[model samples]
Target: NYNVLEQVYDVTKFLEDHPGGDEVLLSATGKDATDDFEDVGHSSTARAMMDEFYVGDIDTATIPANVKYTPPKQPHYNQDKTPEFIIKLLQFLVPLIILAVAVGVRFYTKSPSA
Candidate 1:
């Protein structure tokens, strides 16, 4: 029996069908597996599926003091990275543009030599 969120779940039937494999579920037995569950970032459908295995709730008094439920941190997806070629191109072009602007400024601002 796997304990998660103070609820008991009999995942015996789900062991073979689990995407992570039976070992993962077996390892979660006899303990609060909420952290493992949350860490996997199971989808809403997966969460709904667990309802079928729901057995009962664990008594709060019987739970150990060390056992606490802390939600997993959300993963950061960085979509801001420019393509390598684009970055390299920018690196080459920016300095060239600045040099061109400096040269143009110097040329225009120079005093006419008599």
Candidate 2:
């Protein structure tokens, strides 16, 4: 079983074509081969080849609790430390402040009669 999904594959047939050799596949027989398979960094073609050998999925209830897969949780952003609101406000206001100053300087530099 791999990632809580039972993979039915023809080890005998795959062994003949396996680039790593038959011994590697033999060692993983009747066991979860996910770690070994990932560590090798198999090519996309190798992953695609699995489709032909797939039989069907195993029920999640049948899988042992310890071996069940859970996706990694995403890290939460600390908004309090970064002050995102203030950063966004400054981003919007800074350009307007510069434009206002430029206009004021141009007006002041002009002659009263102009």
The estimated TM-scores of all candidates read 0.50, 0.47
Off by over 4 Å in 1: 1-5, 63-114
Q: Which structure among the candidates has the greatest lDDT? A: 1
lDDT of each: 0.89, 0.83
Instruction: Evaluate model 1: give its TM-score.
Output: 0.50
Tens-digit lDDT track of model 2 for 1-114: 434556667668788888999999999887778899999999999999988877777655575568666999989977756888789889999999999999999999988994
**What is the per-residue lDDT of model 1 for residues 1-114, given as tens digits with 9 covering 90 to 100?**
454448899999999899999999999998889999999999999999999999999776666768678999987855456487678888999999999999999999999999
Q: In candidate 2, where is summed lDDT lowest over 10 consecutive residues?
A: 1-10
Clashes of 2: 0
Task: Kindly report which residue stretches of model 2 are placed more than 4 angstroms away from their true locations once superposed.
Answer: 1-4, 63-114
- Worst-scoring 10-residue span by lDDT in model 1: 77-86
Which residue pairs collide, candidate 1? none
RMSD of each: 14.1, 12.5
